[model samples]
Target: MAVPTVPRLGPQIGTRLMRRFSSCPRAYSYADTLPNLKIGAHTRVLFQGFTGRQATANVKESLEWGTKIVGGVKPGVEGEHLGLPIFPSVKVAQEKAKPDASAIYVPGNQTADAIEEAIEAEIPLVVAVAEHVPIHDILRIHSMLQTQSKTRLVGANCPGIISAIGKCRIGFQPLPCFAPGHVGIVAKSGTLSYETVASTTRAGLGQSLCISMGGDVLAGTNFVDALKVFEHDDDTQGIIIVGEIGGAAEMDAAEWIKDYRRRTTDPKPIMALIGGLEAPTGRVMGHAGAWTAPGEPDAQTKYRALEQAGVVMVNHPEKFGHGMRTLLARSLSKSGTSNTLFGNGLQKRGYHATRRTTLASIVGYQQKRSLYLKEAQALEILKLKSVPVAEGDIGSNGLICISIDRSALSPCIVASSDPESDPRLLRRIPFSYGQATVENHPMMADLADQLKIPSSSRDQLGSIVQALWEIFKEKEAFVLECQIGVSADGTFAAHGARFGFDDAAYRSSGRQEEIHRLRNTSEEVPEEVEAEKYGIVYVKLQGQGSIGTLVNGAGLAMNTVDALTFHGGHCANFLDTGGKATSETVKASFQIICSDPRVKAIFVNIFGGLTRCDMIAEGIILAFRDLHMQVPVVVRLRGTNEELGQQMIAESGLPLHAFDSFEDAAKKVISLAGPQ
Candidate 1:
């Protein structure tokens, strides 16, 4: 039984926008300016939590990368960090700095505060990169975001947005994966965004803009929102989407694609990849929004939906870049233009590469001659040193490979004897975000005498470390390694070093020609990059599943499915509104559940510790009024505010039946589901 994860499905979310902005609907509409979703190299960005360690590092990177950072906001600190002025509040910073957008680098707990401040200041675009933000907070703030006109938020748990062609990066999207071209990208998974760029860039089709719609159950901006911006942007000739298993967003995007094809004389080409196909069901994977919920579209269903809309499909992650290049070549050959409809010949991209015993034989109409065609494909492996990926620093460091881990949301340097460590000597050195310096780098020895290193070698190593740091910052490398060799005289020199830096960096880094001279494009497949942060997990049941379970929390959603199935009941879908579901989310859940034909009845079981039953009650009333559902709904409320919720439900006189006992509620839903 496919359980639940919360993502604002496109259609359902559209309904929300209409109502929220009904007061002055035109203000929120997508205009030529794309006031919120669209950004460029010229966009002025503000850093919230400016004095913060993470914010400092990000601001430093952004400034170095050519992002037009006006200033930042951090309460109780009005001085400057990195030569940018700081203010106590967003409003003050807005008045002084006059930023076009706001980039939030605060914790999940403080995310709402940061976003609300940006919204109140009327920041044109707000980008939040914090992860694991409370869903209820999102629901609340998302509502607030709608009522206003001036602000459009990118993420609460997202990688943020980047304009690759423009050289403006708000969030920490890898620069090496991007190249300036005509393809615009919007994706849920961050790593998949890299994959999309990796594919398109290798094809010599680079990105105009790429927006990372963070993998939370909810995001301020979604796939459709990004699409409209792409449609409007003159620079973009094509688009690529990286979607996961969760939500109806992709289906909604397909509808938009179809509409775009119908309305425009020449539509931009689109390529898409949906991951999490082999993912297991009913739990939190890497991301909060990566899982399929009840009544939501599955990965396979989404893939076909996109293809039906004239989108070129990427069959696998590894094939994303190469497959796209292949498909576009085929499309261009037939159409003679970029209005590429990958029709008829549209199959998964490995026919030539696949092992086949037979060759195609072409016979003439007269049967006079037969022309047999075989294949001649390249058989070569990728060479090392051609790729810029770093090897361990080889000299006094003793072949130690170093990497940065951010699992704790802080920079922790991982040092190991083996690059791919098993049973090996491993050391983790975690430091404050902005604390690592050439002098204080964990690997860099503080006192030469303390480590018993010869003063000459230590000084040489320090110089190497300083040089590496300078190059790292200037080149914007995600990973870089240098191998140094020392002789008997203690004179050390760099020998056969490995380098992995941003592809975009060299372009603007003034050393483009020099870097190019070092190596051509590395054979690094960006698809191999790790998958980005996402939401809950669910395995969509293909057969006859009936009962739609609306529950709070991922852990309990699975349990509900198990119990229902054990009781001879099948679940049509699972929707987890999180622990703190508001009335808006509850109504959305009802809308989603009712839209599913298989769900004859709904069993809403709420524990309500963080969730208020009163809100659910209110949502039930709203759903009945708005949705006008045919199916019966069984309500089982427990925990906080249960009595008031029951009273409200009882007084409403709606068809919703509230049961005190789980047995009664289960029996009622099961009976209703079993019948016609």
Candidate 2:
């Protein structure tokens, strides 16, 4: 088999995003890396879900690769093997032959149960090949393995691993594509890993271990977790990570590598390739974990972040070995260690070498530096106009620095640090200082940071605070009232009004008519229609309860809420965020509550299908922020840039909750307002 020398850009974003939506964080398990690429050809193995077509194909291929297949299990297919000895259960298979590991080919829905059964049988390792498993199933298996453990889980949708020269294979790949060697391969896709392994083999290099972690929203292990095993294994000299998109998992791994490299004298040379350039925008991909919701990590962005963190990026997968060899050459030269190049003269090929940093990066840096320079200049202009001053520093450290002058108090000016700045802060302050918005300033350095003004240049002073103060002094028209907030049920409540952060005597004046109505009726009987129309009733439930209802799109919503509760989150009521949603219908749906007082937090998951997110966003903003709804709402919007929807909430200046991950949004809402 040809060993892959370079890393391939594989399918990534959609899975990661799907994982985010599913609310499953990829588990980082370091112990899964086997001792060496040397798996004895005689090691016994079994198939857990052996009756399925995919499993049957993999079983045939695995046996072809020289794995000692002893038995199989398929519930009712007991005692009848598809081609091998078939047992009724994993226990029966285990009794017949002491297998070291077991491979699973169950459907996604039944994967966790299959893995759990394998674990119970004391199998050392389990490889799952089911794709699109539910998050709850992944988590259940993960939790079981973690707290009350047995076998290590490989994947529910992965290609499995190959021990190369040892000639033992567990996944679904042609074994002729790999040969044992020193380079370690860890990837998110089965096909991608095969490509890398194939390239390395062709280049005459061998693999220590080639692991194709599944691309589900929740993989059994993450890159960093797997790296720990590679680092400890004596055979691994260099490691290549093939990442795609969705979350910051790669970045998180890169950050870990930075710390790991700094701490260890003999850190392995690491290379990375991130894929997902042409990922579809609004649909969940093949893997449930591959969902790339809006604003979550994407492939290109992850690549850039990894590169900045000092990981060498290979532009072409075919050139991965070259990059690794180059880094190895540097490391070897730096250590003054004499080594011989073996297998093939692939490293000696006179291919064009590319520099990591290019002209585009330099130009981008210069642009940012210039923008910051202009901001400081503009701040100088504002100080001449009359704004108050509080000076702080960047501290040579990155933390924000600023000080507030005691005398610079106005009833309209609320401190930016105050969480509940009056919403009216918009009215008092101009949207822009010429071209800048309220987004600039805690002094002026904040403006530069917001504007992404470059920090490194003698000609560029980072003194944004001083310039802003100077500009404020000169600009009398830059009046800004504190940003606003109210109770969930629409009772007017300002931070300064309640907390008295500053002397409360200086709070912005004028209560709204709605606020007055709510405040007055807070003690008396409230007008039911008006209260129901404007305010959301919040109730907390604290008891052992099971069963949750989710209603929305035909199939998606059913799976979503069911999967959520199945994974341990208690779902009380699922209200469709769309489907002829009028203010009156919204009110009616909310009031009809056999579940309300008991329903934890309402998860309003809407993907804008036929319905525009802006309309929903607007409705939500009005119901909660302006009208003072009492319950915390968890909202997920897809199907549209939905930025317009986002912008509408931003303009209202209300603390409307929004998130790209349905899981993250659900978690946040549940934590804050779920049943007690």
Candidate 3:
């Protein structure tokens, strides 16, 4: 998630390579001489299964494009061929040619082996051009790459990576379509990648690095991984991400980009184009991994997600080049800079420099002044200042004390009066907890402005509180414990007082005790401990004895809740099993719902995507048999083996009711629950 900053631009290479190249004048001079060197310029590649006809043609084309294909690997062809040395294996090739990178043109069945050989040989980068590799084998190859941590894999069914600036081709991508420039392209489809590169080059906005991340069910490298690489490549100032429908990789990339922008002062601009806009559901479009399931992200969903994350969504693949050009042009124009490709455009856009504070400064300030005010003194000062005091008695410790009516309070405080309502008082109070310094003064203030004072005038109390806030604003003299909250019966309750914002003090005080009491007595569940513990999310509703609802996916869960609520039925809790639900997880979810004494009926609604519906039905049967629950259970299953799941539920011979329609299930569950 943490992206390393691109090396600073200087006479030498960017900061990333400065440590190694700074010591070598020849390297620096070579870089200085070229200036447009791509990210993989130093990469020396060895081909796996090099003696094959396909490998020979691709390697020859790559060599003709000025790529550094140092050597090749074949089981028996271990000598020199086509002016390049061939070895028995990657390890042997490595010792002889000392290749730092590798490309695989081996058959689908042998693709995993080739990749494994490259990884074992410690080749830093491996690109697999073979297609139709088994999912399990790809998984193993991905696991190996992860365990090694040093090697980066590009594809199983991909066009591979091309560095136009470096004149290097590691995959099967046609070299004639690319040109060296500042823009970088990361794509999921092979033909789409070519189209992107061709269009960008046509627009005279050539690319620095163009990577086709492969069209496998689980790509070894995802959009986020490629984005990180582009983020740190000095040669790439603008980027275009080409995504397809199926997985959450695009969404993940969008989230990562947002985080990256927040961490770095200046971030390179990024645009995206998601494919499969008109493609039908359940149909695999060319790529084996391009088929999307129900409730999973589609093209429009990805577009919205990326757009919300600040990535410009190009409507068409043809517009990719124009979109990037316009975006970069606007950025440069906003900064009042020329069309230079490799400068810090982010800094010019008013990105603040990183803030650094020493630990000594914090410790020294805390040590300078350490003062505590007794409760009596604190109350007396507030009383003298004409501050509105709630009807409460001063405790032995001088803290105000009042009895809390638990029945009058809600399960949770949804909204409270603004702590900083008075503009004069706001000037003295720290805006955030981080800004709270030891030097600030602690002052008594009304927690609720609605609290009435029979003895004091409102205007007089406000003036006094403002004056006190100003006096204590310069020093850490505020006692946060003097705060109050409104009871359910419309009475102001004063609790324990503590100096400053001390978490431990607040927790130990009567305020915390009241919260604990409410949680214990209230029908509402405090947190989703059980669901969260089992790696799922659950949200409890307000009323007790309501129908409990369980479903897969957030969208499905929300739809179920809305449908139940719309039909005059109350939901006891909302549980999302997510995409990878198991029988164990479903049993846990059922147990959680049944634990709520208020839940009279359990409504299980699942639309499986990656999760199988049969697994959910099995869990329901297990829960019913094990828990021996009295509550009526209503189940509705859809998508991915739903018919088998329905049959299993029917054969269970349990009192559980199964339905095909969500509406029927909701109404049936509500009717079974009866009056709540």
Which model scores highest in lDDT?
A: 1
lDDT of each: 0.58, 0.48, 0.58
Best by TM-score: 1
lDDT (Cα, tens digit) per residue for candidate 2, span 26-139: 342224334322345656778887777767777777777677888778786666665678888887778887787788877666776788677667677788876545443453
lDDT of 3 by residue, 1-676 (tens): 1111121222212233234322332222211211121336677888888888988888888888888889898886668767998898887888888886788988776777777777667676778877656443554444334323456777877778889998888887766667899898988866556656766886899999887777766576677767777887988989888887666688788899879878976567787666654333333343545544212355556666776677766433445676678777877766421223323211111111222322211111121101233445445545654554454543211212111111111000111122223211211222211112211213223311333343233334334335344323222222223444443454433322322211121232222232122222122234465575676667666655388887764434544564566466778776767545677778888888878888888898775433566887888898788888788889987655778888899899998888766667778999988886
Which 10 consecutive residues of model 1 have the lowest summed lDDT?
373-382
By TM-score, how accurate is candidate 2? 0.46
lDDT of 1 by residue, 270-382 (tens): 77766544333423334655544322344556767887788776433333455556655665565533223433223332221222111001000111000101111000000
Order of candidates by lDDT, top first? Answer: 1, 3, 2
Worst 10 residues of 3 by lDDT: 404-413
Between prediction 1 and prediction 2, the one with superior TM-score is 1
Task: Please report how far candidate 2 places residue 564 from its true position, in Å.
Answer: 38
RMSD of each: 27.4, 23.9, 20.2
